[model samples]
Target chain A: MLVRGVTGMARVVPETRDEILAAAARRFAVSGYRGTSLQDIAGEVGCSKAAVLYHFANKDAILTELMAPAIGMLQALDERIAAHSGAAAQRVAGEGFVDLAVRFRREIALLRGEFPELLQQPAFAHIQRISERLIEALAGHPERPAARIAALVVLAGISEACGEFADIPDEELRPALLALVRRALEPVD
Target chain B: MLVRGVTGMARVVPETRDEILAAAARRFAVSGYRGTSLQDIAGEVGCSKAAVLYHFANKDAILTELMAPAIGMLQALDERIAAHSGAAAQRVAGEGFVDLAVRFRREIALLRGEFPELLQQPAFAHIQRISERLIEALAGHPERPAARIAALVVLAGISEACGEFADIPDEELRPALLALVRRALEPVD
Candidate 1:
């Protein structure tokens, strides 16, 4: 199959669903979910819109596919954190959250600024629940306002770091981000 | 003039453009920019869509007006911070950024998750520039990658705190957010 590379040159490649998803994810990250259209994705993928629809039911389907891996990983981390207690759980939650943010930086960047619109779609409902669980774990399941606020700041801080430092290779960004999160989560003397 | 209170009961009062903007701001903050329509604003204000259109040219107009004050205040803060040097500038930027977030908590909530969409609208162009300046100020105008990353984290942390803790009166949230920013900005000694 022929695909248009970033240089606009025609190159032979396998026409696979992953290619379509990669194109969609790139477009969504750059243009935003609301700003991107299925046609746009198809254009980027060098396929017909109907061909794109053949693999995914709709744009929401594409988004669901794009985020499913990250969501699954988060849910698994949520369960693991739940199985722990105190500082252990907070540590697990913090590390897991940052790892996921680093791994899925593009998806995070795409959704971070478009959360309100994402919430309105049924496909993204699990995000809120997963995020709340992560926060709860990060706060060590505490009911105190300070812990909750701290957890939120850490989460937001990591997310924003990942999004803004997208050009930085993950290996370099991951430790830097984890260090920041650790400092932010430290108890105030 | 009549307006609909939060209880859905009609209250007789003088209808004014401020009322429409207030209603639109509330709706946008709660439901999001794309989720809201002029009719929704009109319904909230107990006025007609025509009345809303009479005051504002379009939805973007309402959003522009809603954010103008915050933008102006941020620009002023930017100028003030620009006059300072090194740690002094960073300190001023941190406090001013958090103060602005606390003061315009509702507006922050409305815009926090809608940045990509806002960028598409020409009315919000200055937000990008102001945000860059704030980030630079927060970094003490440093050229280091770590400093830049730290500044981004501080800004995002305070914003997320304000948006999530909107119900916690500004007086209470201000100190907590400032404390978080201060800690996040500390050097990694």
Candidate 2:
């Protein structure tokens, strides 16, 4: 019985970490990284700040953890698009980018509002590289002005949609965002 | 000749204020509002921090003065659009928004990257109201979810385009951005 109880407690540990992360994400999204403090997150999570620290080294660690999954997904999308070229690459990258944007809406909100400082951090250095690579893939690796501008518009559209339409359900927002992105990328006459 | 020299000296005062604002805008864009210091702005302008203070009351004052013209332009656009309806309003607001986005590219860059904290200050309170009114005008005052989403996407696209395509000359970028905004607002079907 004691062994079973120990196993049960082990399962709860990871759940607690996730709960802490969720609380941190919400706080950071609403108040911003510089504006939010550990005490605020702890209050939201209903735990002591020290207890929050026990699960995460610090607030930056919490931010890093919150974004790690999205970063990994972006990196994977980058790899997936690397195998394709031309319009095929653009289509692949676009679909994957939309998926990631909708799935990680909160993180994208934090990023859109606070990217300069966040991206400048050494821990997020890879995110900048991955984003540039993703942009290149979406632009079909073209250095042309039109293609570059189109990629940027589509990207900005996706990020802003996620933040601005918070009241809309993701199921509704996903197709709307993808359609808008497609329109933005349509050939200019 | 003495009077002319005095007039020239008077002109220099406003010029110095302009120089200080330009330097602060650049620093805020690169490092964000929280990360930048008054001393840094002074350094960039090759003046004492005290000289910077002489022109503006504080860092927040510098930010407010930098954004005041853009906010005023938005208010004027809002009033102009108030008299129009449906597609006409969207068109007018879109053109004005694009022009402001391009003309105030540096300010838009700072707003896009650091808006949440910057907008919360009391001095910038009017900016938030003006932005909402502008968005309403852009959306043709529709409370519908799709229209609201489209307006946001277009606004975000324009703002992001101005920041991302800094190398593209404004003359070339203006038409490209306006075209993209129009395309993004087209019916999804």
Candidate 3:
């Protein structure tokens, strides 16, 4: 019984860590990193700061981990866009982008809430590269760099609208938002 | 000679403050508020933190002040769009919106980067309201709500391209960006 209990307790460790991450993301998103404390995260997780530290070396580590899903989702969406063919591909890619935008509010808000200085950090270089690559891929018209610009604008537009103005109902907003992006990607006269 | 020196020094004060603000905006745009220190700003100004603070109360105050021109510029853009009259209002608005997007790199970046959460704070309610009103006025497409969404999307699109992706060169990149916004604002088929 003791060995069984130990195994069970071990399983809960990862779960607890995830709980801490979730709590931290929420806190960091709503309250800027400076405004939040490990103690606050501990309180939210019903654990000690030591335990939180065991999961993450520090606040920055936790934040970087919390933001992983957002980055991953964006990359995955790009892959999905590449895989899909025809109108279905466009719709799927657009929806995935929209879904990520709507759901990744905390991560997006946290990033936007911080300064661009975050971009200069070597740790975030992957994100920049990914963003640039995504733009390059999305710009089907190499002749008109506007397509690339439009892609970025659409990407940023969705992120801002979803993150800051989430109070607006998604059902009412998604179609219009998607329509706007579609228009943005279209050729100019 | 003494009176002349006093007048020259007095003129220098505002000029110095403007220079400081410019430096702060550049640093803050690149490094963010937490990453930046008064010493950094002071060093750039060839002074000390005490001297920096003499010009502004604190980093928060500096941030708030940094927003003044951004707010004014957006407000002015709003006025320009609202007052635009004639057959090509949509087309003209698209061009004007793109112009604002290119020029608003620092302002949009600062707002989206450092002040996103500040939107929820009671103190920044006025600022929030101003942006909201501006967005509403810009996107007031009488034909449909999609127009409104498109307007917000265009603003957001530019923000994403310029604010976060600061590495992109302007001369080579802006035409594409402007084209994207122009397409986004065009009447839907």
Candidate 4:
């Protein structure tokens, strides 16, 4: 009976860990860092608080895992956008924005939600650096504030629209959105 | 001694609340929602956990309050954006985008930091709704997906630049950013 209990307890650990992460994502997504607790996460997983600690050190670790996929996806999207260079750069950038907008709406929303704290994290600093590099590569100058601002505006607006404007279908908004971005990238008079 | 303690305690409530919020903002801004704690916050404010809770019912309430000001500012910016109409709409929208870009940079960075959950709160939802309304009012139609998309692209690009490209000063960025936004709103082939 002791051996069986040990085996069963071992099986419970991984499942409990997954459960804790899932629960933590929901709570953190809604309540943020300060609002959640190890106790609350343990309760959701139907495990002891110590069980949660065994799998994950703390809530921060849980949040880190949850957002890892999102960060990866964003970087991938950046790569895809960068792939659209040369004469087709403009069109490719537009399509990339549309693709990202349509596919990653939920992730974008989560990012927007968690963004304030995310910005301060060392993990996110690399993403910012990557973004700046991408902007420089695309605009041909790290110091082109106008181009940088224009790119940011387009990206943020798309994120905002995709996450919030569910009533406006993607197809309807995609073309106009691209046109706007292209215009924004144009040299100032 | 009891009377003196009671008076001291009473005097501490409002100040403690403000202190907690301020500290929470700093922590949340760095560590994010899942990374911070009421205990950490209390330590910052030089108070007990119970005292922190005495001011805020929970972490959610604290985050909600921190985000409240950002939401209000966005709303006010939207109102200001809406106040300009007609042929001047494009130019006014450009200017508004620049102003909001400057204002929202820190808060947006903070949003990206710890209190990401605030994005789901009604406060953010309200900002989204108001922004949509402002877009509609400026474009004079919800069906103008093209124009709406254009506006979104321009505004979003500018906002993104402000946060990710802080190395660039506002004086150089602001006017250039305005021009980029104006260009985005212009007719495209």
Candidate 5:
């Protein structure tokens, strides 16, 4: 019985960490990272501040881990997008980007200005290359300044809209989002 | 000579106040409200902390004043958008919204997650109504959830992109942005 209980307790440890991440994400989304407090997250998780700190060294540690998956997925996207060029690349990126944004709506929301000096941070430095490549792949016309702006809007807009209208059922929201993206990336007149 | 010196000092007061507001906006946009401090603003303005406080009570006060013009413009956009219905309304709002966003790009950047509990603030409460109406006007097909999502993406996307690509000249950026908005609002296939 003692050994069985130890195993169950071990399982609960990971579960508790997941719960803390969820709580932190919600608070950061709704209150902004500045507005959220360690105690606030602990309170939501039904844990002590000390316990929360034990799982994650600090708020920044929690943020780094919480956002790792999104950043990793962006890397995966960069590779897939690398296979194609011009229109083919844009098509793959646009569809993949939309799906990624929807799948990680909350994570994307956290990206907008969550770290304005994002490139300066050692943890977030690689984002510059991945995002630049992604934008390059998605841009409608590489030479024109306006074309680049449109791509920025489409990608940034989709990420933000995911969180803004998160409650909208995925089946209903995905197509509309994709349709808008297609229009933005259509050949310029 | 005493009166002339006094007059010069009075003019300098407003200039100092303006300086403070400008410094705060840059700091807030970069480091975020939570990351920035009164001392940081003062340091930027080449003024003392006491001087910054004298001009504004605290960080929130400065935020309110600096964002007042942006909010006021949003209110104005609401009136212009109210004049039309359906596509016409979307056109007016889309163009007007993009223009407003560009004109106040930094302020719009500050809006994203700058205040997650924005509606709760008494000063910013009216934004709830204005933004809802603006999104309603910009949405492609009112009957579908997707259209609403599109509108949200367009408006939010423009605001964020304005800050992200602030370097692109207005003449080059404007038409391209408007073109994207028009495509997003086009009749469904």
Candidate 6:
């Protein structure tokens, strides 16, 4: 939150909650989710454990909040894809997925590392359902084994690309990634 | 080992060494490398812990041996790609990778689930070197960021597809994978 400084000039106020989440994300990424603790997050944020706890109930709460935006975007993409059918649906799903994956690379890295079990948790279960819908939309013809493989490839390929080309600027990588997904989801003869 | 039975018939003898390795892989896959123990391996194989230790010195030895085949094949792919230049190299690399990924879905699952830290060890170091080589081979023109992204996507995408479409038979998934990769590596305007 912003507030006036001592001299009456506008200044940015510290948002301890956002800072805690940022620290937690960094800690969780460097060390596995299981390896990181509230203390570690607090230490990174230059705060006490009590301060960290003050912002969030626990580690899961912090992670869930950090992930909330990504999950929301994914759900939005699923909803968008639902309106289209066949090839149009596949294109929409591909574009939306690439955008989602690019914007949430850290979340993808977090999901890929140390947290498959988390997806089974009630909080993350809905993500699995959204993913299934996105996959179905991307597949075009869901019954064909070939189409199924293509859709799966696009879903996973983009996330992989995000990590692999982490050094590349998103603006440069985005088109390449989008093109790859478009091709990967294309119907095979 | 085959031996003569009491009735003078050739009987296939139980190879305790192979049995121990098989049990260790299964245990490691399901419970993770760190999560499993020699006692678990021995119990699964219906052998004593000493017997398990006698065959393999430790858990790392078992993992090293289990991953030996995959690392070997990946090196072979890298070597095959070295002989060709440009698109031919990309084609050979893609086909070789698809074959390798299809044949080692369980190994990929094992890598994905646990033991990523295991990759940095001396025993698994060669896999990393080979993977970089394979990535270069897959990318026809490494200087272009787009080409780089495409190659990285296929490398990780195939592994992801292997797990995502695990239920699909190799004969069915393999050709579809190959086609999708072929398209992914194609030049984009």
- DockQ list for all candidates: 0.56, 0.56, 0.56, 0.41, 0.68, 0.48
Error of 4 at A59 (Å): 13
Candidate 6 Cα outliers beyond 4 Å, as residue runs: A1-17, A35-43, A46-54, B1-20, B31-55, B113-116, B187-189
Q: Give the alpha carbon lDDT tens digit for every residue of A18-113 in model 3.
A: 888888877876776667899999999888889989988877888778778887888787777667554455456556766776667657766654
Which candidate would rank higher by lDDT, 4 or 6? 6
Model 6 Cα lDDT, one tens digit per residue, A1-189: 223255755535457777888788887766557668788888888788999888788778888888888888988988898898888888888888888877888776665534446777899988878878888888888888777777777777666445455566779867988888777776523
lDDT of 2 at A35: 76
**DockQ sort, best first:** 5, 1, 2, 3, 6, 4
> For candidate 5, what is the lDDT?
0.77
Q: Is the docking of candidate 5 incorrect, acceptable, medium or high quality?
A: medium
Candidate 5, superposed: residue stretches over 4 Å from native = A1-14, A115-119, A186-189, B1-14, B186-189
Global lDDT scores for all candidate models:
0.77, 0.75, 0.65, 0.60, 0.77, 0.76
Tell me the tens digit of each residue's lDDT in model 1 across B1-189: 452465756644545798898898889877778778889999988888999999988888888888888888888898888788678888888899888988987777777666756766777777788788888877664576666777788777666555677788877788877777777675522
Per-prediction interface RMSD?
2.0, 1.8, 2.8, 3.7, 2.0, 2.4
Better of 3 and 6 by DockQ: 3
Q: Model 4 Cα displacement at A104 (Å)? A: 5.5
A176 Cα displacement, candidate 6 (Å): 1.3
Query: Which lDDT value does model 2 have at B126?
Result: 76
Could you say which candidate leads in TM-score? 1
For candidate 6, what is the TM-score? 0.83
Candidate 3 lDDT score relative to the true structure: 0.65
Q: Candidate 5 residues B3-28, lDDT tens each?
A: 32455455544477888888888988
Native contact recovery (fnat) for each candidate is 0.57, 0.62, 0.94, 0.80, 0.88, 0.67
- A5-25 in candidate 5: lDDT tens per residue? 455455544477888999999
Q: What tens-digit string does per-residue lDDT give for candidate 2 at B112-172?
A: 6566567778877777777776777676646766666777877766675566766678888
> lDDT (0-100) at residue A75 of candidate 3?
77
DockQ-wise, the better of 5 and 6 is 5
